[model samples]
Every structure is written in C-alpha cells, then in structure tokens.
Target: MLKLFRSAASIAALILGIAGVFLVLYAWRLPPFTGTVQTTDNAYVRGQVTIISPQLAGYLAEVAVQDFQHVKAGQVLVKIDDRIFEQKLQQAKATLASQQAALANSEQKRRSDEARIASSKAQVDSAKAALTAAEANWKRIEPLLERGVTTQSQADQARASLDQATAALHQADAAEEVARQDLTSTLVNRQSLEAAVQSAEAAVHLAEIDLQNTRIVAPQDGRLGEVGARVGQYVAAGTQLMALVPEKVWVIANFKETQLAGMKVGQPVTFTVDALQHAELTGHIERFSPAAGSEFSVLRADNATGNFTKVAQRVPVRIAIDPNQPLAERLAPGMSVIVSADTSTAASDVPATGTAPGATPPAQVSEQ
Candidate 1:
C-alpha cells in the first residue's frame, strides 16, 4: 500500500505542474494560446505642426498673443511695420489716377482731331468749287484773248488764279490727311495709357496684399507654440515667427509584420496614454502604411550583402481617436502610448496578404 500511494502522489504532482505551465502560456498568449488581439507599445500621438513665417520683411511692431495661447482663425498674432506698404499703396493709386487722366486727355485729343478733319474736308470742298470756277473763267478768257476780246494781262491773271485754286486744293487734302494721322496717333497713345492704367491698378492690388500681410494672423484655429517676435525686432521674409499646433491629432502604432495578418482598417482599437496617467482611450484603425517602417529608414540595410538573419519589420498603423473623449483631448503629438487592436471583429480591408511589400519575410509572431 505504501508503494502504491507513493506512485499516485508522484502522478498527481506531475499533472498539476503541467496544468500550471499551460496556464502561464495561455496568460501570455504564447503559441496555441494566441488569440485575435494584437498589441504594441510602439505608438505615439501625432499632429500637423505648422511653422508660421513672415511673407515680407519688416520690424515687429506688436506681439498680440503670448506663448501657448489658444487662437481662432484670422486672429492677429503679430504686427509688422506697415507704413511703407501704406505709402506704396497710395503711390500706386496716384499713378493709376494720372494714367486715367492721360487716357481721358487722349480721348479729348481724338475728338479735336475729328473736328479738325471735318474742317479740312469742308475747306477741300470749297477749294474744289473755286477751282471749277477758275478753270471755266480761264477757258473763257483764253478764247476771248485769241479773238482779241480780252487783254493779255486779264488772260494771264485767269491762268494764275486757276493755278492758285489747284494749290489750295492740294493744301486742304494734305491738312485732312494730317488730321487723320493725329487721330490715329491719339488712339494708339490711348491704348498705351490704358495699359499703364492696368499696370498701376495691379500695383495697387499688390501693395494692398503686402499691407494685409503685415498683420500676421492665425491660419486656423489652434494653439501657438511660442512668441519669437518682439517690438522693434526686424525679421526677413520666410523667417520663423512661431509654431501652430492644431487640435486634431491621431495615434500611429508600429506593429510587427506578422501581427498584421488579421489586422484591418476599421478594427476597434484601445490605447492607454503614458502622459495621461495611462488613461484608456477608444479609437479605430484608420489606415496602414503602404510600406514597412524599415523602408523609410535613412540608411536601409542590404540583407543580400550580409549573411541574412530574418527579422520581422514593423508597419505603421494610423488609428483615429473617437471624438468627445476627455482624455483624448489631452493627447498631444510625441506622447507615448500602448495600442491594442481587436482583430476578432468583422474583417474590413486588410493592408497586406502575407508579408508587406518592401518588408523582410515575417518572423514567428510573439506578443512583444
């Protein structure tokens, strides 16, 4: 009986030890114990950080907001010296007015030329009538002179009168041509004046744009990072004035390639922020990186050159945070977080079939 009891005790202890090992493996999701939940600590909040710069160079006249101050769209953040821009606008307007006046003057000159042309035409008509009368008189006088009915002097005078009438007609035609030419020149000058007016108007518009740019305003509703400008400090064009961080932010999780087999867009995700006391937040997988993280490295490895040892590559997954969450609002770019995606849900669009393109052959997946 003592030998039988010893054997039974040994069997019972062995069974208990095996059960404990299985339990530990199940808790850690190892091998056969793995499920559809994929998790990674390689996650961070991200946002569009925009750098504010000046479009024109000038001295800082005013700093309206302080560092980290929340601002609305179009709210003035800083003011540059605008006196020069204002003067330029005024000068442009004056130039525009001068060109317009010149254009008007050109119109008046055209009208005067038209009137002169009409006067010239009337003189031409008069000359034609006079020449007709003079030719008739000369013809009558020459016949009378040959018959001895008129004096030689009178015949000579009639011929001379005919010549004078012909000269006067030629002068009238020349005057009319000159008047038409003057009108043509005036019309051409008017076109040049019109172009000048357009150019001046454009200059005025540009000056107005520069003047408006003097007041640096927030491009969107966001918070300022810092105030780098001070009164009387000169800044050049494209100089960085500050940084703006919009309220919209999301999380990026770099999960191993092997873990992406069941992952898909729209999978429910939960994350805990280290900055917010590990407060849990809910989100959904928005999208996946087109290529593995290794593809984006500055110095990519050439596995073909070296002895190959297969290692799993990480693929970035973008998760969209659910709105109206109190803790989600506190999340900022660069904040670390642990993200978990529940892949058991109805599968949506998966990013990769097996190994993602540009990624190494996936290694055996184990919860990292």
Candidate 2:
C-alpha cells in the first residue's frame, strides 16, 4: 500500500508541474497563445469649457437662461442695469454734438479771419499806390521849385502829402500784421477744436462699448450650466455668472508607454462611456502628447535626484470621435471611459510619426 501511495503522489506532482509549465508558456506569449491587445480605463471625455463672466460691474437686471438650458451663439443670456450705461451714452453723444458745434463755430471764425486778412491786404495795396503817386508828385514839385517852375508852398504841400501817404502805408502794414496773427491763432484754435471732437468721438465709442457690455451674449452654441446669477444681484467686474459646455467633445486616453509601440494616428479606437449602458463609441487616434502624463503634474517626479525604479509611464493620446459615431448629443465633459486600441493593423493612411506635411515638431506647440 505504501508503494502504491508513492506512485500516485509522483503522478499527481508531475501533472501539476506540467500544467504550471503550460501556464508560464502561455503567459510568455509562446507558441499556441497570442498576446492580448493593450487596453485601459484611464480615459475621459474633454472639451473647452466657457466660463461666462461679467466684463462690467452692475446690478443684474435680468437672467434670461436657466441651468441646462440650450442657448444659441450670440443669444442674450443676461442683462445688467442699462440705465447708467444709457445715460453715459446719451451724455457722450451730447458732448460730441457740442464739440461738433464748437468746431463749426471755429470754422466760421476761420472764414471771417480770412476775409479780414484779404481786406487788410487790399488796403495795403491801395496805400502803396497812394504812396507811389505822392512821391512822384513831390519829385516833380521839388524839381519845379528848383527850376522856379513851381512855388515853395506847393512843393511843401506835396512833401506833406508824401509823409501822410507813408503814415497810411505803415498803418496798413500794422493792420495786415494783426490780421495775419489773428488768422494763425484761428488755425491753431481749429486744431484744438478738432482734437476735442475726436476726444468726444472716442468717448462716444467707449460709451457704446459699455452699453453693449450691459447685455451679455452667449459666445457659442451650448448648454448653460448652473445659473448662479439672479436679477438684482450686485456683481463686480469679472464675476462668474455661469458656464457653458459646448456640443463638440473628444476623448483623452492615457496609455502606458509600453503599450504605445503599435499606436498611431488614424488608427481606429473603441471606447465605452461610463455614463452610457450597453453602448460603445468608435473613434480614431488623433495625436499623441509630446511628453508623458507625469510631465504635466504639479509636482513632477525628479528621477535625477532620487533612486530610480523602472516605471511604465503613461502618455496622453488624443482620440477624435468619428463625427458620425460621436458620443450622445447630451453627453458632456469629464465623463469616465474605457478605451481599447487594436494593434493588428497600421494606420497607413496617416503620418503616424507626427511628421505630417506642413506639420511642425511637437516642441512648436509650446511656442504657439
């Protein structure tokens, strides 16, 4: 009976050892067993989130949209107390009108000054002509007096007339100088008036901008988030009013570096969203992050100063949803997901090496 028991024990040990060897062989990807594809649940849906904030400080007069309400781009989402803004606009317009009126008055003054200058110039010409005639008469009379052809009194009278004409010419010159100076001053004043007008115009423009700010509009077509703002709520500039989640969404998958050997852009991907039951979505690899996920961490690991251990770091891969097979229309961001990538086929249609035509190196993204 002892010999029989020993033989049975030996047979049992041999069978168990044989089974262990087969399991190791299978785990090691030996013959008769294929390697499983890389898969992970470290993925999520992501998109741009718009944070609506007030650009100007005012009391909220109206809140047009509610939480989860669909809004079209450029639709009015909120209205601030516009009375102040409207008054500012009206004052700015009035100032602009007054400035324009002043400018018109300056223009009229400029014309009047020009006319005065022209009249002064004519007077100077007339004075010059009279001086010329008086000097000619005095010369003729002086020669006549020397030749005894005219009396001394007549020559004296001609001399006095010449003197008078010279005084008149001097007065004309003084008047012309005054007119020219006045004209110069008027031109300078016109410049000041024009500047005032421009300033008023700028004020009006700023007022209009403020008025437009009173009516906040949605920037994109999306669903509204929690409506934290309410009517009569006093808010300051840059205050958060609400949020918007856009309709377009995509997946971000972090895959282990070891599993990235066969991953490439344009390769098909299958993922299941946690929010959806018994449903799956299909997409294609869009791009790969230039660095591993740890690189973006706030406190990144510094292997240079620490004892190093081999770690399978994960890299972020951007996967674009096939527009036709995108997540549900109501799906939002931050949703959890599981991703599976097939390595059996290559994406020959795309430049998986990140060297597409006209594409810059990954480092250029930081610069952009």
Candidate 3:
C-alpha cells in the first residue's frame, strides 16, 4: 500500500509542474499562451495648453477675470484704456466727412464748367459770323475807293471798323479756348478728389479696428491660469498675461521599440493615474510617434563620430481617453500614469482614433 501511494504522488507533482509552465508562457504570449498584454510605466497625461496674449499695447484699465476662473468663449477677460483710441476714431470720422464734402464740391464745379464750355461755343459761333461780315465790308469799300465812288476818308473809316471787328472776334476765340482748358482741368482734379475720399475711408476703418482691440476676450472654453495682469498696469503687444487649459485631456505612453513589434492603433489600453490614488482608466491607442523620443531631443545622438552603445529607445504612443468614462472627465494634464496595452490577436478591439500622418512636424522652440 505505501508503494502505490508514492507512485500516485509522483504523478500529481508532474501534472502541477506542467500547468505552472503553461500559465507562465501564456502571460508572455509564447506558444500555447491564451492571453497577451504589454505594459509600461513611462506614461503621463497631457493636453493642449493655450497661452494668452494681447494684440495691442495699452494700460490695463480693468482686469475682469480672477485667477483660476472658468470662462466661456468670448467672455470679457481684460480691458485696455480706450480714451486715445476713441479720439482717434472720431478724428478719422471727421476727416472722412471733410473729404466727402470736398469731393461733392469738385463734382459740382465740373458740372458748372461743362455749362460754361457750352456758352463759350455759342460766343465763338457769333464771333465767326461777325468776322465774315467785316471782311465783306472791307472788300466793298476798297473797290468803291478804286472806282472813285467813295472818298478816301470814307474808305479809311470802313477799314478801321473792319479792323475793330477782327480784334473782337480774336478776343472771343481766346475766351472760348480758356473755357475749354478750364473744363479739362476741372475733370482731372476730380479724380484726385475721389482718391482722397477713398484714403479717408481707409483711415476710418483702421481706427475702428484699433478701438475694438481694446476690449480683449477669451478665445475658447477653458480654465484660466495665474492672472498676472492688473489694473493700471501697462502691457505691450504680445505680452503673456495668462494661460488656459482646456477640459479635454489624454495620455502618451512611451514604450520600448522592441515592445512595439505587434502594437497597433485602436488597441485597448488600461492606465492608472498616480495623482488619483492610482485610479484605473481605460482608453484606446490613437497613434504612434514617427521616430524614437530621443530623435527630437535638442542634442541628438551622433553615433557616427563617437563611441556608441546601443540602447533600447522609447517611442511615444498616443492614447485617446474614452470620453464616456467618469474618470476621464475628471482627469487633468501633468499627471503621471502607468499604461498597458492588450496586444492579443483574435480579441475584441477598441475603437480607434485615426492614425497620424507619415511626416513628422518640426518641434517648436521658445525662449521662455
């Protein structure tokens, strides 16, 4: 009986050992493994942060927002002193009015010139008729004097009358020429007046735009950061006054290059936030970085010219937080997170955000 019990115990021990090995293999995605998951501690919550600035320089007359206040889009945030800008706008309006008046007068003058030209043409016609009569009279007087039918004094008087008529006709022609020139000149001057009016209108528009800039407003719905602006403080254009963090936030997990062999977009991800007492959160893989994180560093590694050692690189993977989850709604940026991805085949997949474009964008560098 003791020998039979020992044989049974040996068989049971062998079976237990085989089961343990199978469980280990399953966790690592080896052959005969039923489950597969990849996890990484190198992850954190991130989101878009908008920096607020001014478009015009002025003394701040009012700071309407308090520090860390939640503001809606188009809400009043800051106010600049608009006394000068208002005056400029009024001045522009007055200038525009004056130009309009000048333009009207020019057009009226042009009309008057046209009428005068017509009168001058009538005078020219009368002068031509008078000139023809004077020439005929002078010819008749000369023939009569030559035939002795008229006296020398009579002929002299007739010649003098003809000369007077000729001078009168010349004067009329000169007056008509002067009128034509005046009409042409008036037409040309009207164009200059039109140009002046357009210029004044542009000035008025610019003044109005500047006045509107005095009242600064929020660009989107977000929570305000530290409000450094104060009433009576003089601020310059493009001065940073505050920051805005939007409500939407997500995470980026940096996984080892070797671990990305079978990872893909739309894979379900599980994460825990360190700030929230390690509260578990779920998401899906949105996209992957085009290159390793080190490639974007300010001082890139140059293995071609120096002693080098190959090291496993980390590639950032974007994860879109499931908006329906309560925890996702409460999550904020800058929180540390531990993320894991299910890399199993033939498993239910999570819906995915679209993949990123193939080309990488240039990194932005700022001094402060």
Candidate 4:
C-alpha cells in the first residue's frame, strides 16, 4: 500500500513539472501585441484623366489618333472642318481693312477742316486791313469837307466806302467762326468712326481665336481612351470626344474612423496591385479626408431620426507613390490594389527603398 502511494505521488509530480515547463515556454514565445490593426482589400490605383472636348462646333474632318495610344503634350489629335472658319477669318480680315480705310479717310477729312479754318482766318485778316485803310481815307476827307477844300459828295462817298468795308470785315469774322465750328463737328464724327474701327478689330480677333480652335491637341502626356468622334461627324461646342489618363498613379484608401488614431499625413504605406502580380509599390499618406466619406455623398445618413445606432465612418486617405519603382508606364486609373499602411514610422526613418518588399514589417492585423 506504501508503494502504491509513492507511484501516485510520482505521477502527480510529473504532471506538475510538465505544466511548469509549458508555462515557461509560452511566456518566452509570446509577443507584445499592443494593438491589432484592421485592413480592407478595397483600394484602387487612380489619376487625373483629361476629358477632350471641342471649343467650337464643326464637323470633324479627320481623327489623328487611335484608341489606347500614347500621346505627348500639344500633339494634335483631331482636326475639324476649317473651311467655314477660314472663310470667317477672311471676312474678318476684309472688314478690318475696310475699317482701317475709313479711319484714314476720317483723318484726311480732319485735315481738310483745318485747312478751311486757316483760309477763313486769312480772309478775316485781309478784310480787317482793307477796312482800316478805307477808314483812314474817310477821316482825311471829312476834315477836308469841313474846311471846304473837299466836296460834300466826295466826303459822303468815302464814308459809304468805309461802312461797306466794316460790314465786309464783320462778314469775314463770322465766316471764320463758322469754319471753326465745322472743324469741331468733323472731329466728333472722326471719333465715332474710330470707335467703329475698334469694334471691327475686336471681331477680327475673335475670328482668329475660333480659327485656332479648329485643330485639337492633347494637353499632357497620357494614355488615350473613350474616343467617340469619327471623321465627318458633326460635334457641337463643349462636346466630349475622348479622354486622356495621366501616367502617374496613386492609391485611394478608405479607412475607418477608428483606425485613424495613428494614421496621419506623411506616414509610409506598402501596396500590391491585383492586376500586376509579383509587383509591389510604396506610398505615403498625403492627406486624410476632412469629413467622413458619407458626409460628402449625395445622400448622407440621417442619424437625427432619433433611433440612432452608432457606426464607424470611413474617410478617404490619399497615398502618393514612390517614383523610384519600375512603374514602367503600366499604372493606369481604376486598377484594383491591396494596400497596407504603416502609421507608426516617421518620414525620415522611411527608406528611399520605400518601394522595396520586406522593408515595412507587417503589423498584427484583423480583417475589416
């Protein structure tokens, strides 16, 4: 009975020893999981796509580009029927020429008016000199008639001649005033003609701008898409004809409000595209949405209905890609990607090999 008790004691001791060892091993292997982050697979590669539209309405004469083709900035992509535009331009030029001629004619008329005014002034001076000489003769004859050395009829004749010369001088002065008034009126007319010329010149400038718009060109280096117009198709002003997607790409991550505690601008991020396997990319948190994504939507949730249930909201985080990667002109808009961001690290600690795999250590995470 003592041997049986000893055996049972040994079994109990063995079990206790095993339990202690297991505890020690577990304590050594366990990691400090301060926090567990959640992630989502919903992410995409995006960029600015320029929508090509016409500035003037016309039938398309030719399409100089094809779908999915690469194009450079200022490269002509289409041509509109310029016949009407060219005609309009010619008409404007003709109108401008006519206006210029009218302006020149107005200047010439002003000169003629000045000449008439000068001639009238000269006549007034000549008449004044004649009247002075006749008055001098009459003054001498009146004294002689009173002394009886000159006849009364001769003296009266001299007086009448002086009076006629005075009247002629007055008429010459009035004619001179009339000529000055005419010159002033002509200048006013010239100004009105000058204004008309200015209006015609403005129309000419507009016609020139319209003529330039007949040829369309790409605004930046991008991939062409959605080319809807064809040769001989009449397109109106502001009509969308094609789209150009820029080569540069970025990721738009919709992160929940709770996860944004440490997520700040300039934090590093690692990403993988579903379209391009074996390819990884790196980026930084450029900015966070100012408000929840729903707040910016067309129909925001109304929690004011009184039956309120608390729910986490998401905000869009923009992540700019590192330019050193072998992006190779392959990144396009709306491409699906899996993004993982590291909000714990500083911008300076992040290596330039940001795009390198195995650089950012993955965090202990949960699925969102």
Candidate 5:
C-alpha cells in the first residue's frame, strides 16, 4: 500500500509542473509595456511674462498702475516727465510753421517773378513794333535822299533815330530774356522750399510720436507683477520697470525617450498639477522635439568612448490644454504637471486597410 501511494504522488507532481509551464508560456505572449512616468507631489506651472520697459529714457512722473493691478490694452501704465517732450513738440511745431511760411513766401516770390516775365514780354513786343516803324521811316527817307528831296542832315538824323530805337529794342529783348530766366529759377526755388516744408512737417510728426510714447501704455491686457518703478524715479531707456503676465498659459513636459514610442502628435493627454490636486485638465500633444534633450545642450555627451555606457534620452513635448476652462481653474505657466498621453487613439483614427501615399498598405486578415 505504501508503494502505491508513492506512485500516485509522483504522478500528481508531474501533472502540476506541466500546468505551471503552460501558464508561464501563455503570459509571455502578451503585448509589451512599461510603468508610466508620473509624479503626485512635485510640479511647476510656467508661462510667458513680458518685461515692461520704456523705449525712451526719462524721469518717471506718475505711476498710473498699482502693484498686481489688472490693466487693459492701451491703458496708461506710467507717465514720464513729459515736460521736456512737450517742449520739444512745441519747438517742432514752431519750426514746421516757420517752414510753411517760408514756403508760402517762396511761392509768392515765384508768382511775382512770373508777373515780371509777363510784363517784360509785353515791353519786348512794344519795342519790336517801334523798331519796325523806325525802319520804315528810314526807308522812306532813303528814297527821298536819293532823289535829293531830303537834306543829308535830315537823312543822317533819321538813321541816328533808327539806331537809337534798335538799341532800345535790343535792351528790352535782353531784359525780357533775363526776366524769363528769373521766373524759371524762382519756380525751382519754390519747389525746393516746398520740399523743405515737407521735411519739417515730418520732423513735427516724429516729435508728436515721441510725445505720445512718453505716456507709456500697456501693449496688451494682462496682470501687473513685479512693479519695480516708483514715482519720481529716473528710468533709462529699455529699463525694466515691471512685468506683465498674460492670461494664456500651458504646460511643457519632458518625457523619457522610451516613453515616446506610443506618443504622437494630437494624442489626448491628461495632466495633474501638484498645486491643484483636484483639478484635472485635458490637453493634446502639440509636438515633440525632434532631437534628444542632451543633443540641444551646449556640451553634448560623446558616446564614441568605448567605456561609455548608454543612457535613454528625454525629449521635450509641448502639450496645449483646452482653452474653455473656467477662469478660476486656468493653468498658470511654469506650474509642474504630470502628463500622460494616450497614443492608442491613433489605432481608431487611422484607416486599417487603405494605404496612404508613399506608405505600404496595412496587413489584411484572411479567413483560414
């Protein structure tokens, strides 16, 4: 009876061992996976904060905004001592007025020159008519002198009168030519003065722009932060006086290179920030860095050394959150967030059978 019992026990042990082996083999055939990267207690929120500075240097006169104040776009943030700017603007206006007057005077002078030219042309015509009459008189006297009907003295006087009239006519013609040249030159001078007036006007416009800039205004609607300037402070150009935090904010997650295998653009991402434990925000993967984080470092690691050990790289992935969240629950930039993207969505979104351009068709199942 003891030998029979030992044989039955041996058979039972063999059957149990075979069953365990089969279970191990079955578990090995499942899909591969790894533990997700996450953090429950550590993270930071971050976003873009614009540095508020003056484009022009001046003494700060009035600080229009208080610390941590909310401001709308184009609201006056600060007022520099605009006294100097105002004086400059006044001086520019005065200069432009002066230039405009000069231009008007130049135009008036040009008109006067034109009038002189017209009068000169009339005088030239009168002189030409007088010369013609004198020549005819001299011709009639020549016929008389040839017939001895006119005395030599009379003929000589007539010739002298004709010469005098010719000289006067030539003088008038020269005067007319001078007047015409003067008119042309005056027109040119008027055009030049007009150009000067235009230039002066441009200077005035620039001065006005500068004056407007003296009243510093917010470029966008944002929250005020880090108010470093005070009333009566002398701020230089490009000096930072405060900071403006915009309402828009999002998260940047650095994921392990191995974790990105299933990560893809447009994948749905769920994030948890340490500060707001109860707040769950949904975002989508916008993009991932093409290169590893180490590659972008100033001194990248050289793996050429034979003694070097391999390390998995981490890549930066940008995830944008839904914009429809409540104002109270909006995420601020630089806030740490634990991110998880579901790449399995690609399976349903992608066509299973149709082949995309430049891609091979997916495998089709066959009924066996």
Candidate 6:
C-alpha cells in the first residue's frame, strides 16, 4: 500500500509539471501558442508643441494668460509696451502726409510753369512781328536815301530801330527757352515727389506691422504652458514666452524590423497607456518611417570599423489614435504606451512595404 501511494503522488507531480510548461509557452506566445498580433513596448504619445516667442523687443505691459490655460486662435497672450510703436506709426503717417503735400505743391508749380511758357511764347510771336516791320522800314529807308528822297539821319534812325528790334527778339527767345526749361524741371521734380510718397507709404506699412507684432497672439487654438513673461519684464526678439500644446496628437511605435513584414498602413491597432492604468485604446497604422532608428541617431555605429554583432533594428511606425474616446482627451505628449498591431485582418491586396501609396515623404521622423 505504501508503494502504490508513492507511485500515485509521482504521477500527479509529473502531470502538474507538464501543465506548467504549457502555461509558460502560452503566456509568451511561443511555438504552438503564437499569435497574429505583433506588440512592442517601445511606443509613446506625441503632439505638436509650439514654442511661443516675441518677434520684437519690448517691455511686457500685460500677461493675459495663466499657466496651462486654454486659449483660442488669435487670442492675445501677451501685450508689450506699445507706446513706442504707436509713436513710430504716427511718425510714418506724418512723413507720408508731408510727401503727399510736396507732390501736390509740385503739381501747382507745374501748372504755373506751363502758364509762364505760354506767355513767353506769345511774347516771342510779338517780337517776330516787330522785327518784320523793322526790316521793311529799313529797306524802304535805304532805297529812299540812295535816291536822295530821305536824309542820312532818317536812314540812321531806321537802322537803330532795326538793331533794337533784333536785340528784343533775342531776349524774348531767351526768356521762352528759360520758361520751357522751368517746366521740364517741374515735371521731373513731380516724379521725384511721387516716388517719395510711395516710399513713405511703405514705411507706414512697416510701422503698422511692427505695432501688430507688439501684441503677441496665439497662432492656433491650444493650451498654453507656464508664462515666462511678467508685467514690466523686458523681452527681446525670439524670446520664448511660453509653449502651446495643440489638441491633435498621435502615437509612435518602434517595432522590430522583423515584425514589419506583415504590417501595413490602415491596420487595426490597440495601445495601453501606462499613465491611465493601462487602459486600452483603439488606433490604426498611419505611416512608416523611411529608415531605421539607427540612421537618425547623432552617432551611428560603423560595422566595418568595429566588431560586428547583429542586432535587431527598430523601425518607427506612426499610429493614429481614434477620436471620441473618453480617455483620449486625457492623453498628452511624452506618455509611455504599449502598442499592438492586428495584422491578421490586413487585406491581402495591401502591400506590406510600410509606405502608403501617393503619400509625400515627411520632412523628419520622430524617434520617440
């Protein structure tokens, strides 16, 4: 009876050992217990975080937002001392007005010069008529003096009148030429004045732009981080005032290269957020990185120079988180998550090349 009892106990122990081994295999999904879902712990939540900064230098007049405050697009976030900017705008306007006045004055001068030219032309016409009459009188007097019908004194008087008329005509011609030159100069001066007006107008526009820059506004609807600016604090151009976190976010999963053989865009995905008590969320495969993770590193390993040991390379896969989930709003950038892709349901027609058709290449790939 003792031997029989020992045999039964040994048999039960062996059966239990076999069951434990199966359980371990099933948990690890190895051999007969393999699954179609590919999973990786190297994943994180990411969003576009915008750094807020000023484009100009000024003392802070007002900080309109608190830390982590929700803001709307174009909402004023900070107000710089705008007194100087206002003054500058006014100065530019004054300059523009002065230029315009100069242009108008030039127009009036142009009209006056035209009138003077017309009057000089009329005078030239009168001078020409007088010279013609003087020439006729001189010719008649010379003939009479030769025939002794007129005295030498009469001839001398006629010659003197002709000489005076010639001198007068020359003076009138000179005056007319001076008047025409004056008109040309006036027209040229008007062009310069018009150019000056345009230049002043441009200056006014630049001043207005600077004034607008004094009021730093939100570029989009988002939540602002801590405000680094305070009342009366002087800040220069490009000084970071705060950070803006947008509402749109997604997940990045770094999977082993071997796992990418079955993965494709639009494949169903599920991820568990570590921050939210491992709550599972649904998503889909959005895109694949163009290169492996090592290619983006600041210092890359050179296999030719060093002892080569083969290591599995990680490829970043972008996952789009589904909207309207209650926990999705709570998700923030930089949160750790575990991602799994269900490749079993992937369409057979879809190529597993990891890139979508007709998609533009991204400028940069995020490793995290």
Best by lDDT: 6
lDDT tens digits by residue: candidate 2, 1-368: 99999999999999999999999988654566645466789999998889999999999999999998999999999999999999999999999999999999999998999999999999999999999999999988998899998888998899999999999999999999999999999999999999999999999999999999999999989998898999999999999999998888888999988778776666788988888873798887777887888989999888888688989899888887877654466457998989988766655665443422233544432110
* Cα misplacement distance, residue 326 of candidate 5 (Å): 2.8
Evaluated at residue 231, the lDDT of candidate 2 is: 96
- What TM-score number comes out for model 2? 0.87
Q: lDDT of each prediction vs. the true structure?
A: 0.88, 0.86, 0.84, 0.80, 0.75, 0.90
Give the TM-score ranking, best first.
Answer: 2, 6, 1, 4, 5, 3
lDDT of 1 by residue, 233-255 (tens): 99999999899999999999999
Candidate 3 lDDT score at position 112: 86
Q: What is the C-alpha lDDT profile of model 5 across 210-316, one tens digit per residue?
A: 89988988988888896888998999989999999877666677776556665555566777776677567787666555566788899977789769877867767
lDDT of model 4, residue 204: 89
Which runs of model 3 end up more than 4 angstroms from their true locations?
1-36, 136-146, 151-174, 345-353, 356-368
lDDT of 6 by residue, 254-317 (tens): 9988787767777889999999999999998888887899999999998898588999899899
Candidate 4 worst ten-residue window by lDDT:
353-362
Model 4 per-residue lDDT tens digits across residues 1-368: 99999999999999999888777766543234224333546678889988999999999999999998999999999999999999998999899899889889888888988898899999999999989999999989988999999998999899999999999899999998988888898889888888888988998899988988999999999889968989999999999999999787778888776667666556778888877883778877665556778889998778888788899788777778877787625777898888777767754664342222123433432211
Among these predictions, the greatest TM-score belongs to 2
Model 1 clash count equals 0
Please give the lDDT score at residue 117 for candidate 6. Answer: 90
Quick one: how many clashes does candidate 4 have?
A: 0
Greater-TM-score candidate between 3 and 6: 6
Deviation in Å, model 1, residue 228 alpha carbon: 1.9
Clashing pairs in 2: none
Off by over 4 Å in 2: 1-36, 351-368
Which window of 10 residues has the lowest lDDT sum in candidate 3? 359-368
